[model samples]
Target chain A: MLEKGRISNIQMEFIMVPTIIATGVLSIPSIAGRFARHDMWMTPIIGSVIGFITVFIVWKLHQLYPKMTPIQYSEKILGKVGGKLFSFVIVFFYIHNTGIVIRQYSDFITGNVLKQTPAIIFSITILFVSALAVRGGIEVIARSAVICTTIFMITSLALLLLIKDLELGYMLPLLENGWLPVLKGSFIHNAWFSEFFLLAFIFPFVHHSAKKGLKSGMKTCLYVMLILFYVHFFVLTMLGVSSVNQFYPVYSVVRAIRVFGFFENFEVIITASWVLGNFVKVSVFLYVASLGLAQLFNLSDYRLIVFPLSLLLFLFSFWDIPNVVVLVDYMTKIQPFYFVSVQTVLPLFLLLIALARKKRSDHV
Target chain B: MIGEWSIILLVQVLIWMIVLFEWKNLKKASKANKITFASILILSMILSFAKLEYLPGPITLLHYIFGPWGWFME
Candidate 1:
């Protein structure tokens, strides 16, 4: 095993939830609002169906292999060359995806809260912190996740302060366009939800039965759905359709919170908490990329590559993305399909082939 | 010009620090491990000297494959 660490189902939940919700909450509401309008709150509810399906697929695949990650199992299921090709694609997809994720994090910080600071500085700092966590192994990431995710959940409660300012009328005229628009809104969300496939990398190291992992994975999906629904509800009610105009709708709505007519400027607290959440997000992806590369190349240890790969990730974040506008454009249009194809569709094929191969071997 | 040079210098410093820290492990590691580490490090160093924003990258490749489909969202 490349990783000797064993994590419980609960630790798995802690790591996985923030991995999805950390980035989803910041950008999704506005993107959903673009299509669903008053019906935007339903987007997460619809989108989480993909999360559930992805968790089941990952779980089923893990059940078949039981002792191997997708990197190892792909070689078992496909011929060695085909499997290596597939593994290379999966690993490269994640490396590229992680770069975009780091870019999104830095963009949020530099474009919004720390306008004077250079964006690369924020990326490097977060990548450096995450590199330390990745080097410590999965137990360290999960343990830190428990603390960071808790702070993220608590700070997110500040959104409740905006209850008085909500115009419930904005949510009326429900389905203003129709179910088609709501489906369109959920399309982008399915991309985020499909990230549930990341659990496959962690599942082999999980110390529980596959059943328990499945249950926790489903529960995490529910928790994410509710959290996203809660954020979208607030953003839609407080900002209405204007939420679509703001890049960071959750940040915008949080900025509008005025507690007891005295306490304001709470966006900074939310941003700080979000940093904690993104810390977990980036670390997990960094760890997966390093581990995946090690497994792909038959390296003795993943730790040696963490720093160098981070430098590559740094280069990737700045690669041809000139600004947040292009970043958001990529997310809305290309990312959904790109993420789904590699993470979801590819795994589905792997599962089907593995199942067929198993039945044949049984008959033989 | 100064800012760009400083950024390059900072990257070089970071690279050396990583190499120095991992030198002991690298000395005793397998040939595959050394080659992969050195290759990735060299790739990053070369890219760091160039303007990354102007470089054709994965995003550009993905855009070429999926750019036409992006219009469907409109």
Candidate 2:
């Protein structure tokens, strides 16, 4: 398996930070702002708690089984047939999530940047790029993320420059709806946070202690929360209620930056930078899904199946979800529970089972 | 019509080329690996040609299990 490429703790952090922030930076404010209102800034912070929980739980699992991924070690915990079934569940989850992510990117790009262009074009292209990244192996993906991190920093700075356009008054009337709405607003953000589970697929590939892994993940989660807080604050202040009504709130906020009325429409550059993050996101999930499939069948190499998997991803990207509206509804309503359950609750259970097994073995 | 077929054919050819390129390695892979590779390729190719209408997708599943979730967007 290409000698199981290894990335350092820092490269893993670089890989994860942009991976989590990419979609949230441009997408979360609008969705979270729907319920959050003036308190939208708080969602990411509260949401980060879920991220921390996910990191810790997955870290515990990693500590228990250092040599294998959750996919590979589930057999030890669940026993043969059950393990393969669980592995398929994890694989299918990632596959389905990757498809939805590609579709989300496709919808945003086709809806905003390339109007009249088919969403499939964006989907296929991004999948192709992600496939290339996946084929290059995790080390390659991590190194590429090192470069993309620069683009991400520049984009963040550009967003910071938009503060002059923000109307701080729009953030007034905080807690008008009490903490309930803020808590509700964090539901979707928690779903994003729950994505920290993907690190389980990645954690085994890194040579680090579980404590350091959790530290890196926690730090990334905190930084992502800060960035998401800024995004929500920026959009809510710049566009106010108009931000909630817009599909791409952060993109709209970026659009509002009119430097001297000539240096305008930075959405293209922001999106170009955003693509690097999306590439890492898709590549990571694709790599893990293929890895799971390979292990499920005991294949010698995961890269052998990347192409066919992309085909599945392309097809699934347009799966039963139909339009973006329904996609948004599903994501808002069902995805939070579904993702948290599958990504966190399942692993938490698996960890318990693994611990029990360990105790039983020690006794025996 | 013809254009759709062309697109589907193009995707199939592309997938086959990749699989075949790696077939040397896959040739020695387990029976499960070969079956998995073939099954996904064929399944995706078939789905790509199928009508999108026929696929009710996750929305319907969510609607059935979770119940009329479209209101959340409002």
All candidates: TM-score: 0.98, 0.94
Tens-place lDDT digits, model 1, residues A1-364: 7899989999999998889988899889988889899999999999898899999999999999886889999999998999999999989998998998998998889889999998889899999999999999999999999999999999999988778888999999988788998988898899999999989999999987476989998999899899999999999999889999989998888888897789999999889999999999999999999999999999999999999999889888888887888888988889888988888999999999999999999999
Best by TM-score: 1
Which pairs clash (backbone N, Cα, C closer than 3 Å) in model 2? A320-B57
Model 1 gets an lDDT of 0.90
Supply candidate 1's per-residue lDDT for B20. Answer: 98
Query: Which regions in candidate 1 have their CA more than 4 angstroms from the true location?
Result: B1-3
Q: How many collisions per candidate?
A: 0, 1
| Candidate 2 per-residue C-alpha lDDT over A172-213 given as tens digits, one digit per residue, 9 for 90 to 100 | 887998988888888779888998988887888887656588
Weakest ten-residue segment in model 1 chain A by summed lDDT: A205-214
Cand 2, B chain, TM: 0.70
How many collisions between residues are there in candidate 2?
1
CA RMSD (A), model 1: 1.3
